[model samples]
Target: MSEHSYIAGIPLVLGGNVFGWTAKGDGAFAVLDAFYEAGGRMIDTADVYSAWVPGHEGGESEAVIGEWMESRSVRNDMRIHTKTGMLGGAELYEPARVLHSLDASLERLRSDTIDLYYAHKDYPELEIGQIVEAFDGAVQSGKVIALGASNFDAARLGAALDAANATGATPFTALQNEYNLVNREAYGPDLQALAQSRGIAMLPFFGLASGYLTGKYRTEEDFAKSMRGGRAQQLAGGKGPQVLEVMDAVATETGASLSAIALAWLVRQPGIPAPIASARTVDQLNELLEFTQVELSDDQLARLTAAA
Candidate 1:
């Protein structure tokens, strides 16, 4: 349906991977409050979030979001987008097993239904039709409004769409991939074509390149700032710096934060209704909120695109 994507009209979807890890309790609540008051309506989380952290098995972010929505009573006002198939691999994608995980995610999210549920990643070893049927099963139960594919390449996502059509199953309406300025390979020309043709909106993750595009990690010496600083260094070695250089010039001209400029650039791209990014603090969220105000001209977008 809706040409604006299922979430419809949200400028940004707040990333929730850091909710129970780097941000928690009052700190996490503050950021959530800021985002909501600033008109942010969607949050992207997964069953496997925070599992990489020591002592965290999984579902930490979901639980934290659940607590926030319950305590704040804003569940109806927000759109929740979460994923599955990341932790259990091929076996979890079995139709019955995938539905089981959907129940668990719904419980942890403290919701009767999820606005959007994604397959997390493509399991190519399994049949593409099987994967489509598995997620479509959730839609059949009315627990999920729409299905999405995360980390899926062009060929596989296209195949899954075709399978859904053949089987009369609900096709994926949203695509979440590792798309950003530096990492352009994840959502390249082929992927872009599919999203446009199928009317699937790409809610690109890592929109800030894990903080590299934020202009915080400009040099090797600045790599000690956070956990993703090493990734920043890797991004810095390639097109990261060049993109940041262009972003810096634009920021100077418009008095906007690099985070805002980066997200602003992403929103202007084709098939991207909104970009998914995270902020660890209220101050950080305010910086990200600046994206709503920063509008790039055609020439500026071209320069950032050329740099990337």
Candidate 2:
């Protein structure tokens, strides 16, 4: 069985990638305040978050989150999830490396224990037993409550589970895949089935397709709205416009914004506990938090599923 109960009611995981990158300091704090005020419980970040930015060496986002927690005095109220792979100059998925990376995460988050820790990317060549043992060591140290795997395929996830079972470590309780209206194939069939069979909670990243599903970017002009515009063009490719049309219809039918409806669909999926989405401002957060209260109907869901 899973070891974490971090996300139960909230329909979304407030993505922490924007902290210290797009929403630094007070701006990030405001977004966090908005999220908790609206009943959000889980905040997802990583040790390597925003490390791709110039002059950043990673852990910047986690530091901001720790500061927010200290400032707000609600550390116990929210579940903190952070990843350990692909940060700084570290290699991926080595057992000894996992120890060092998580220690760094602990210091940055200023927490004795993380509610959930994920291997940011799966390393296929590594022995599953070794990986599972590494995570179990964290749990043994009382530094992590549960461990998760992101960016892994069905076969690898199955192997990880077997290793965890053999080593008697905390099994993976959650999954973070690139799942959204535009990006479906990555986590479509095999991963979905495996997660369901193992009862692992699904937490999809790129939940809004990098803000494409928000209905704000429909043309070349809209691309200028974000520095991530070039990446957003993938959504504007084949059938992108058609998907937007369906989303628009659903928005009209449900009286929900396109972003909310999109997230509601993920929440309504079989294994998904919450969809991970980031907001750079309180205004954006308000729109995302609304998904906690919004429910999409069967027809609306069908429309989206088919269109997507």
Candidate 3:
């Protein structure tokens, strides 16, 4: 099996969770168009996206992306990274279930091949060898180019890697987890070190701390603006404001938006190449895109790291 890097030239993976949920139809298309026009190459989506909605049954985001790609004729120029094993409300990581979900994802994305396919989360109850073999089958079948593990702890990830090595199955090439300025415990030093040692690319989701790091959700009243405000509310009572203060200082020093500083800090981490974030509008996307141009100094990064 050949090892492949999932990231292209850009250091941002556009999150597709907003599509068909908060941003739909022309709005979703506009954001996607702006992202690609700004040199974004990868999009992160899952088959279970928008399932929490009242009338939705998931795959809505993938269908929107599929239609967008078909309409824009930009399939060849873009890298689509999607996840499975998190839907169907059934047993997770079953070999047959994994393949079945993949086929459904492929159908929704309107693509025969996926550049990168991720297991949405680790199922420790399942044998690592079984998971490895299931994902490896996709690679051998030319359905998925690379395999990734999301929301996996360091020890479990290491075990999965060992299982792959012993069985000669394709190993995970990327890791996706809840990593950001305010939330560091999940993907802390141990996990970062493991990823670096294993050469697994890190693409952290919730890179903006669910909008708390965006400087828009400062006071309790700010939570009233979005449906996901509860997440920001939880951060408000803790170190969220303190972390924002450090980000504010860095933003002032670099003239970058709070979103950019947050993402820039993520990119500077040891094994991270990009951070996954979503924008409901072109304006929000522009703010996030600024991170590509902003460079944080060692001191600024250190201060942010220490404050969080």
- For candidate 1, write residues 127-242 as lDDT tens digits: 89989888899999999998899999999999999999998999998999987778888889999998999998999999998898888888767888679899778756667777
Best by TM-score: 1
| Residue range 115-208, candidate 2, lDDT tens digits | 9899888766677776777777777877888788888888888888987887677888788888888778768788888888898888999898
TM-score of each: 0.97, 0.95, 0.96
Question: Compared to the true structure, candidate 1 yields what TM-score?
Answer: 0.97
Worst 10 residues of 2 by lDDT: 87-96
Report lDDT (Cα) of residue 45, candidate 3: 96
Q: Estimate, for each residue in 1-308, the C-alpha lDDT of model 3 and write its tens digit.
A: 11355687578999999999999999999999999999998999999998999999999999999999989999888889999877753365767777788899899988888988998887877777777888888888878889999988998899889989998888998999988888887798898899889999888999997888899888667888779889877754588888888888888888899999999999989888888999999999999999989978989989999986
Candidate 2 Cα deviation (angstroms), residue 135: 1.7
Ranking by TM-score: 1, 3, 2
Stretches > 4 Å off in candidate 2: 1-3, 88-92
Better of 1 and 3 by TM-score: 1
lDDT ranking, best first: 1, 3, 2
Q: Please report the candidate that would top lDDT against the real structure.
A: 1
Q: Which pairs of residues have clashing backbones in candidate 3? A: none
Q: What is the C-alpha RMSD of each candidate to the true structure, in Å?
A: 1.4, 1.9, 2.0
Assess the local accuracy of residue 287 in candidate 1 as a C-alpha lDDT between 0 and 100.
90
